[model samples]
Target: MKNIWISCAGIHDTLRFTFHSQLKVMLTVMNRRKLLLAFLACPILAAAPAFSHEGHGVSHVKTSVTLRKRRGRTLHLIVTFLNQGRDAVMLETVAVENAQVLNAVKTAVPAGALVEAPVSLRFHDDVPGIFTLMLDFGEHGKGPVTVTL
Candidate 1:
């Protein structure tokens, strides 16, 4: 076999072109992966704030009552107040049936705190089986809670 001389120039060029084409395909795949990851992250980014502030932004006070005693037309109550706002609240006054009594010692409820106060309601006619109590939390807010008879 005499020295067979063959030109490898076309082979080298083909190899170089294949390598560049593969590189371009790899870069395109990488870009697509990045776009897919970004699309998947959108919902998680939007829901992050909702999960962090769950059950928050409640700016008003909540009130509940328990009947301590009932004698004739008078109903003694133990009113419970829950301040959900950021600032403290004061129970300024309580009104029932045209009678309003200013709290001598205002009940103070710290932020996110609960306080119980003794309240008496005297009905001139007849004490109903169930009644609604309206609480005045000064400038904070008002809560109207129903009391079972």
Candidate 2:
């Protein structure tokens, strides 16, 4: 009877030690999981600016143009627009020489839309003069539209 009691007590001690060790391991694992979760959430919270600048429900317009001088008498112009407002917008591009309209291109952009159009301007090889490229955005003309020559 004495030996049996001693053996039972030893088994109880081993089980208690195992339970404590397992409890510590579980706590460590849970803590690591929480830290990883927090790290993953930070980038998602910081990405608001990328999503908010895409027109949204308001009218925000942006324009960019690239001009490349090609061989002979042709100039390639690539124009792009992003409408950030809730309303549709019309865009017109006019090439002016001494305030005189030489050539023009017109298009309409829907709300929250992006448009990239390429236009080619041909000038006579002997035409050596300064010209103005104007981007007119209807009544919203001067604002919201950018011109690159």
Every candidate's lDDT: 0.71, 0.62
lDDT, residue 73, candidate 2? 58
Give the winner by lDDT.
Answer: 1
lDDT score at residue 118, model 1, on the 0-100 scale: 89
Q: How far is candidate 1 from the true structure (C-alpha RMSD, Å)?
A: 12.1
Which parts of model 2 are misplaced by more than 4 Å? 1-59, 98-104, 123-132, 142-149
4-90 per-residue lDDT for model 2 (tens digits): 122346788767766776777788989999999989998998997886654343237777777655545566667777887877877
Name the 10 consecutive residues with the lowest summed lDDT in model 1.
96-105
Question: Model 1 over residues 16-132: C-alpha lDDT tens digits?
Answer: 766776777788989999999999999999999976653333245777888888788777788887877677777776766533333324788788898899888777677877767
lDDT of 2 at 8: 44
